[model samples]
Target: MTGPRIALFAEGGDWHAARLGESFAARGAALVRLSLDRAMLATGTETGVELPGFDDGLPDAVLVKTVAAGSFEAITLRLGILHALRDLGVPVWNDARAIERCVDKAATSFHLARAGLPTPATWTTEDREAACRIVARECGQGPLVLKPLFGSQGRGLLLVERPEDLPPPEATGGVHYLQRLVRSPAGLFEDYRLFVVAGRVVAAMARRGATWITNVKQGGEPLPFTPDARMTRLAVAAAGAVGADYCGVDLIRDEAGRALVLEVNSMPAWAGLQSVTPVDIAAAIADGLLAALPQRRQLAAAGG
Candidate 1:
């Protein structure tokens, strides 16, 4: 019998892809690296998607490491392919629905709020005047962080301290996502990233930035952190809220010392976390993906 074949959806030559490949290899699994941008969808009497390199057949499961950046239509179509694969009874880890919910900051916040998770107050609107009012009203009390509705790694983030400082609606591309910037009680510009796999907090790290944005890609330094019960519960709940099989849940401390969720990422890069943490996250994720294959396939086949 052949080992479970997995299609890794990530850009070629990415370090993450190499690491994941090694982990899967150790587990006696075969991984085919393919870029979603290069993958095409074919529909007919029998609908299926095709990757340029995976001509043999569709894999048993797809492990999504990254979703490439593209125009709205392109991104949607890429996610649609993942959706198609899931519909065809192939297990897609962090399935299309989960990716959609997490990629869109507004949707993630809504889900977090709905679940009564400790997330910062947030507002998303397309109306310029409405956004201005929201910024003006909220900024007077404290700073509000303006961010792209669909982005990661803390890019394109602005901390608006004054109403007049708010970018015009046209500048924001007609949509605005604003969240209250929670200040740490200790006055440190830091946050915790809890890496969760299969509903457990597998590893964690504290990221302290020179300023407010604490993303590792943004020059933040990562340090190993021990997870407390509260942190574990909040991170796990946030992941569940976004329906992610594995994810990175960012949390910050408020002035009153309460932990609040900042964001949840379905397709998270863990190099920074791995550097400071001792856990073999890649191995854990690989094991989880393999373990989920049989059950996920069963669920998909049963119309679940």
Candidate 2:
């Protein structure tokens, strides 16, 4: 008998996809690659959905590896497909709702604050004048980090130390997303990325950077680090705040040594985290997804 078939929503043959394929194969499951853009909603079909490679029926589960960047309508259509699969009894890891919360920095911060989780103070506004006023008011105390509301990989970030540093609305995609810059103690540039699976911190690493930005993609060095009790608790709580099945929770400490969550990524890349840890991160995620299948199927059967 054949084992379960899993769908991996991603683009191209990336390194992450390869690792996940090998891990799922080791566990006797077949991982089929599918792009969200190509999936469609066919009402007259047997399954009412036209997902590539699943013509006869739906897969046992789905792992959301990536949601490719697209126009507003295109992205919404892609997410709608994920929502449809979930409503039709297929388990989608980090489902559309979770993805939305994490993709929008403002939403993520709101959820974190609502859950009483510790995160840096943040603000978002579409009005250029309002953003300038905010920068003017806040810069006296400390610098503000301006970021694109819908961006990742530490791209398009600027340090606003003065009101003049605030750019025109056109330069910021018509919305200004700002956060109070978390200053490192004694000019030390460091942060932590903790990988959470099934509500547990499986692996973690300390990213030491040459500048204030500590993302590995921006030349930060990843070093193995075992999180302490407080860090583990905070990371786990941060993931829960956004309702992610699995995530990479970025954390940092203030001068007073209090840990704060920097960001919660619903579909976080783990190559850097994988390099320093021997826990086989991909296998852990696969195991987590497989372990939840029974319970998810039960809920679906019960019309949940």
Candidate 3:
């Protein structure tokens, strides 16, 4: 049962990291678990490989579960190894570019808009006055959401309806990541996370929350979501917009029953989604990336 090797990039403390390793191990695929934080410093990115003590050989596929974005050395070094492994023909889930793009919410929104995907009315600006005006126009007289451009688990998010409600711009480096508060027609404002793997929708769940913030980390509860044709279409389009091989696209239904992409997560958390849906998301990802490698090779072979 020696299947292709798959590496899971996540901190040991994360349960998903352990669960993923266990899942692949049950299938006899060699699983390497490494935390982005533990990777070596920015000694260079050309062929960045090796930390002080970890060397698990180049894996056939890499699943990035968690990233330490702060420490420049940590993020850059891990990205280096992942990118290097990619160049060596090992499929890195999300790849370095996709990961980089999705990790930055601003960039993800930009790409989604460029791809003609329906995204929320978003306004990001350094000028607070202009941003405030946009928010008032869209969200109606304040109570706008100010999310950090680069944050996970709904951290550092602001719901401001007044100037006093607005924190010092310097508090978050003077960058305002604002979005119009869009409410779903459904009384609960349910949001769906469509888990796309191997270029197909594997499983999905609707997150029902009390507020506009529907992040599971922020008390959103998951429910089985059987995507309709429209839901499936939006999920696939959202994934394509960001070029993520495996992704979790957040979608919300507007009044017109139109599904608008809320966000595209490259390294999306699946434990919660899996708990609600009868699907082995991590294993699906591991298997999908493994399958893609050979197809990629065939494509490279056909010169004509």
**lDDT values, one for every candidate:** 0.90, 0.92, 0.76
Residues 1-304, candidate 1: write the lDDT tens digits: 9899899999859888898999999999989888889888987425578876667778888999998888989998999999998888888888999999999999999999999998999999998778788887888789999999987898889998766777877777788899998998778999999999999999999999989998999999999899789999999999999999999999999989899999999999999999998899999899888998888878877899
Q: Where in model 1 is the C-alpha error above 4 Å?
A: 45-47
Worst 10 residues of 1 by lDDT: 44-53
Best by lDDT: 2
lDDT per residue (tens digit) for residues 162-231 in model 3:
5556677787678888765666785665888999986789999999888777888999888898999888
Sorted on lDDT, best first, the list reads: 2, 1, 3
The lowest-lDDT stretch of 10 consecutive residues in candidate 2 is 47-56
Candidate 1: give the clashing pairs: none
Candidate 1 C-alpha error for residue 269, in Å: 0.9
| Decoy 2 TM-score against native | 0.98
**Pairs in clash, predicted candidate 3:** 143-161
The TM-score between candidate 1 and the true structure equals 0.96
Better lDDT candidate (1, 3): 1
lDDT of 1: 0.90
